[model samples]
Target: MNVLWIFAHPEPRSLGGSLRDEGLSALRAQGADVRESDLYAMKWKAVVDADDFGRAASPDRLVVGATSKCAFETGELGEDIRAEHEKLAWADTVIIQFPLWWYGMPAILKGWFDRVFVKGFAYGVQRPDGRTARYGEGALAGKRAMVVLTAGAPEATIGPRGVNGDIGDLLFPLQHGTLWYAGMSVLPPLTICGADRVSPGQFEAAAAALRERLRTLAIQDPIPFRHQNGGDYDDDLVLRAELAPGRDGIGVHLDT
Candidate 1:
């Protein structure tokens, strides 16, 4: 299996980095070809610019495909973005590894998504019916994605009555909206809590668990998300603009 691991911790010695290493090692050992995007090491750009859309001399004719000349012309973007896109196309499973910061992904990783997931690539795709493709169908339809997040809060503290609603809620946008919407089957995330005070033993356990999880990627069924444009909601838009609905015995519904 080809796997793309996008890591987003500033410190390579941090707990997040260690977990990422462990996960990568395990995936490699399992015979899965792995490619990593180290945001900090790459000094990745956090802002999107006009050049993201290939430049067209004629203002009215600006198109979305990656032009060969644009790749050499766009200073900020290099072969790396194309390499990432190729990795995404090649991989069957993708793992997003990062430390939870301010209830969301780090700016670097978010920017990676914003830039790498481009128009004519990630979104704005078409279907065989000549209709706009929905969440469950696209260029990335058969792929699977899972988040391996580390947080400073304890698991209990992130529960229904705790400071955070639930770990699942915190990741709905990434798991459902981004992955599922991009036509990937997202698996339940494997989150490690109490990151600040985790013991060596706990860390080791977490690594082992992650390895086992990666080994079972093919057999593990993905979280069944409701397809947004499947005519289930009004006007073919997300029921809650930024929230995913929850079904009984499925997962948490942040809006509820």
Candidate 2:
């Protein structure tokens, strides 16, 4: 299995960093070919600008979507963006490692997605029959993605009935909107809660859990996110009322 790990923690010696190291080692031991984008260490530029497309705005206004599409299709994008695309293409699995900040990933990682997952590549794709190819079909149809996150809150707090809300619900935007929307099957995330208070035993447990998750990367069944074009959704991409009858929110869309 080929895996690409995108790490976004600012400190390499921190808990998140240590777990990332352990995870990568475990993947190596499993004989999986792994590549990584250590965002902070790379001094990754987190902003999306006109430079990414190598084009000057004709009316002095940066046309981001259009520029990205043109640059991606014409091979005119800067080296960094293109390199990331190449890595995604080469890997069958993508693992994102980061600390949860304000119930979301850090700014740099969010910026990475904004810049890397551009149009014509990550989105704006189509099937040969002219159907919109996403939420289950697209350029990344055969690939899979998983999130490995650390949260400072206690596990209990993040449970379905906890004050912080269910972990699965909290992560819906990333899995359903971003990863699955790109056509990659989304896997259940590995979350380490109470990151700020982990004891030595907890660290060991976390590492062991991470290793097991890695070893089963190829065989584990992905989260069953409802496909956009699947019969569950109507032609307008809305969920069929009969299916979730009076249900709403993120949980209602799960096929399980």
Candidate 3:
């Protein structure tokens, strides 16, 4: 299996880096081909400008997603984005590894997604239904993805009633909005907590767990999220969650 691991940590000698190395080694030992996108080491560009489209010379082409017809005319990128896209195209599975910064991904990693997942290629794909294609059912469908992250906070502090009020809620945008919307089957994430003061033994355990998880990637069951166009929902179909569980206006009963 081909796996693309996108790592985004400033320090290569940090705990995140060590986990990355251990994960890579385990995947390789299992005979899986792996590719890495080390953002900091690559000096990735953190901003997205018209120059990214190779048409910056034309002032009129400075619009985002305006490159609907703009092909990759120029074979130039700052090496990082180029390698990332190539890996994305080649991999069947993707593992995004990073330290949670400000309750989200590092700026560099977010920028990577913004620039790499472009229109016409990543999204804007069309189907025969005349509907805007991709997201729920598009080119990126059928692939698998997971986030293996390290956090400085203790696990108890991010529980449903903790200071953060559920880590899952914090990750909804990334796991559901981004990955699921893009048609990738996202597996449950593996989050290692208390990285700020984790002992070496604890770190080793986390690394081992990650390695074992990667080994079973092909058989992992994906998170089942309601499809936006699953027919039971509508434009105004607010999740009947608050009013009454499993109740829908269209007589469709959802599993609460």
* 10 residues in a row with least lDDT, candidate 3: 64-73
Best candidate according to TM-score: 2
Q: What is the C-alpha lDDT profile of model 3 across 150-216, one tens digit per residue?
A: 9999999888778965777777778777777667888888999998998979988999899889989
lDDT score for residue 85 of model 3: 61
- Which ranges of candidate 1 are over 4 A from the true structure? 53-78, 229-231, 238-256
TM-score of each: 0.83, 0.91, 0.83
Query: What TM-score does candidate 1 reach?
Result: 0.83
Query: Which residue pairs clash within candidate 2?
Result: none
How are the candidates ranked when ordered by lDDT, highest leading? Answer: 2, 1, 3
Model 2: how far residue 216 lies from native, Å: 0.5
| lDDT tens digits, residue span 1-256, model 1 | 9998989999999988888888888888888899988989988886766675453122333233222211122233446676777778788889999889999999999999987876555655655465555477665778899899888999899886787777777887888778887779888788888889988899898888888888898899778677766654466453543444344332522223
Q: Which TM-score value belongs to model 3? A: 0.83
lDDT of each: 0.75, 0.85, 0.74
What is the C-alpha RMSD, rounded to one decimal, of candidate 3?
Answer: 5.0
Q: In candidate 2, where is summed lDDT lowest over 10 consecutive residues?
A: 62-71
Alpha-carbon lDDT of model 2: 0.85
Candidate 1 lDDT at 245 equals: 37
Evaluate residue 171 in candidate 1 and report its C-alpha lDDT on the 0 to 100 scale.
Answer: 84
